[model samples]
Target: MTRSAIELPVTADDRRIARLAALAIGLTLAEAAIPSPIPGVKPGLANIVILLVLLQYGWRAAAWVSVLRLLAGGLLLGSLFAPGFWLAAAGALVSLSVLGLARHLPDRYFGPVSLSVLAAFGHIGGQLALAGIWLLPAAALLKLLPVFAAAALIFGAVNGVIVARLLAGPVSSGRQSGSCTPPSIP
Candidate 1:
C-alpha cells in the first residue's frame, strides 16, 4: 500500500510573519545576553517587533509573531518547559490579551506608548502571578512587585517609543495599515 503526502501552501503573508518572528527571536536572544540583578527584569527588547506588527499589520499578525518567537526562542535558548519559559509564556498571554482589548481604544487618546505601557504591566503582572503561584509564596512575590513594576513601565514605554519611531520612519512605506483588512488565509 502507498501513502499519500499532504502539502500545505505558503503565502506571502505567512512569510512576512515568519520573518518578523525570526527578528523578534533574535531580539530575545540578544536580551538574554544582558545581565540583570533581578531574575526577570531585563528589558523586553523583542516587544518592539510585536508592537510594530500590531500597528502596521494587526493584532492577529502580532500574535502570530509573538507565538512563533516564544516557541523558537525557547528552543534556541534551551529553556523549553523550564520555569523561566513558563513565566515568559504566562507573561505573553497576559500582554497579548491586553493588546487585544487595547486595540479597540480610540486613536485620539491611545497610541503605541500608552498601549505598550499597559501591555508591559500585564506582562510583568502575569509573570509575577505565575511566580507567586508556582515558584514563590505570595508575600515574597509582593516584595518583588515594585522592582518588576518599574521595569515593566520603563521597558514598555521605551519599546513603545522605539516602535512609534520605527512606524514614523519608512520601515514599510509600501503597506497600508489599520484601514485595510489583513489578507485572509485560503
Candidate 2:
C-alpha cells in the first residue's frame, strides 16, 4: 500500500513574525517622514512595532526587524551616516535591549503598557547618550535636551498605546489557543 505524504503549513507564529516585520518597516518609514524642527528627534513609532515583535515573537526576530528598519530608513531618506541615523541606531539598540530583558520578567509585572514605557525611556536615553557623544561637546545644541525629553515623553506615550492595542488581540487569541506565555514585567 502506498501512503500519501501530508505537508504541514506554516505556523501562526511564523506568519505573525513576518507581519510584524513588515509593520515595523512601514512604521519606521512613516516616522522618518515626519519632519522635526531638529534633525535628530523622532517619534520612534517603529519602536512600538519592535516592542510588539519582541513580546510576541522573540529577541532574535525583533533585532532583525530593528536592523532592517534602520538600514532601510537610512537608505530611503538619503541619510546613511547622518547624525540622525546614529541617534536612531542608538535608540533602537537601547530599546531592543530593554525589550529583551523585559521578556524575562513575570507577566503580571510589566504587560504591554509598562513594557512600552520602559522601551520608550531606553530609546530616549540612547538618543541622549548619542547626542552627548556627537553634539553636546560643542555646547551648540546642549540646550535642546529639555525639548527632546518632552517630545520623547509625549511620543513614547503614543507608541506605548499603539503597542498595547496591537498586543491585545494576540494575547486574547493566544490565551484561547493555550499558547500564551505571560510577558515579563517591567
Candidate 3:
C-alpha cells in the first residue's frame, strides 16, 4: 500500500515547532548518553528547550515540544511504552499543567528560574505519585521523595539559569548574527 497526500505547505510556525522539537529530542538523546551516578538523577537538559519555547511562543508551543520530545525521545532511546516512558510522560504532563497556570504570574515575580523550579517539583511529584500508585504501590517508594526533591531543586535551578542565559543571549533572537543562534529549532 502507498500513502497519498495533498501536500500542504508548512508554515513558519510549523517549521519552528518542528525544529524546536528536534532540538529537544536531540538534547534528550544526549542526556541519555551521560551515565548518572544516581539512578533517577539527570540534569534534564531537554527541559531548557521546552522552557524556551514556553517563554518565546507560549504554552502550546512548549506543550508540542514536550510531548514530541517524550514520544520521540522515548522511541529513540528504546524506552517507548516502557516504565521509564510512562514516568517521563506523567512528569511532563504535570509540568506542563503547572506551567500553564504559572505563566499567568507576573514576569517580575516569576521568570524562567522560578517557573523552572515549579515545573521541576511538579514533574517529580507526578512521577512519584505514578510510581506509588502504579509501579510500586508501597510506602517505601515515598522514601525517595526527598532525594528526588533535592535533585529537582538543583537541576531545576540550573536549567532555569541556562534558559535565562539563552534568553538574554543572541540565541533568543530570531537570527544567527552572533556565535549562538536562537534556540528556536529553525
Candidate 4:
C-alpha cells in the first residue's frame, strides 16, 4: 500500500514565525563563530529575536520561534542532543519561562530592556544550573557565575535596547494592538 502525503495547514502566523525562526537560527550560527574567553558566555544573539517576538506576538509565538531555532540551529550545527545543545536548550526554556511570567508586568518598568535583562539572567542561570547537575561541579558553576552574570547583563541590555528602539521607531510606533505582522526592520 502506498502511504499518503501529509499536509499541514500553514497560516500567515505560521509563515511569519518561520521567518523569525530563520533569523534566530542565523544569529545562533553567527554566535557560534564568536570566540569566548569563558565557556557558555556567548552574547546569545538569537534571543534578540525571541524577545522581540515575545513583545510583539506573545510568549506562545516567542516560544515557537525559540524552539524552532534551537532544533534547527542544532541540526545545522551538527550538535543535536549533544551537551552543548542541552545547555542551550535549558537556557532557552528558562528564558522563555521568565518572559511568560514577566509579560504580565506593567509596560512602564518592564519594557524590552528590563525584560531582556531578566530573560538573560534566566537563560544563564538555567544553563549554569543544568551544567552543574549534568556536567560540572558546583564549585565550577560558582566560579563561572560572576562572568556569566556580567555577560548576561551587558548583552541583555543591549538586545533589549535594540528591541525598544525598534518598537519606538516611526515604522513600528504606528502598530495597532493585536497586529500579527512585524514592522519592516531597517
TM-score for each of the candidates: 0.88, 0.74, 0.88, 0.89
Best by TM-score: 4
Tens digit per residue, CA lDDT, model 4, 103-177: 998988898999999999999988988999999999978888889999999999999988876776554357634
Q: Rate the local accuracy (lDDT) of all candidates.
A: 0.87, 0.75, 0.89, 0.88
Runs off by more than 4 Å, candidate 3 = 1-5, 170-185
CA shift of 177, model 1, Å: 17
lDDT of 3 by residue, 13-126 (tens): 988899999999999999999999878788889999999999989999999999999999999999999999999999999999999999998989999999999999989888
What lDDT, from 0 to 1, does candidate 2 have?
A: 0.75
RMSD of 2: 7.5
lDDT of 3: 0.89
lDDT (10s digit) by residue, model 2, range 77-152: 7888788789888988998888889888998987777787777778878888888877776364467767767777
Cα lDDT, model 3, residue 65? 91
List the pairs of residues colliding in candidate 3. Answer: 171-182
- Give one digit per residue, the lDDT tens place, for model 1 in 63-85: 99999999999999999888899
Evaluated at residue 164, the lDDT of candidate 1 is 71
- TM-score (C-alpha, index-matched) for candidate 3: 0.88
Model 3: C-alpha RMSD to truth? 4.3
List ranges where model 4 is wrong by over 4 Å: 1-5, 171-186
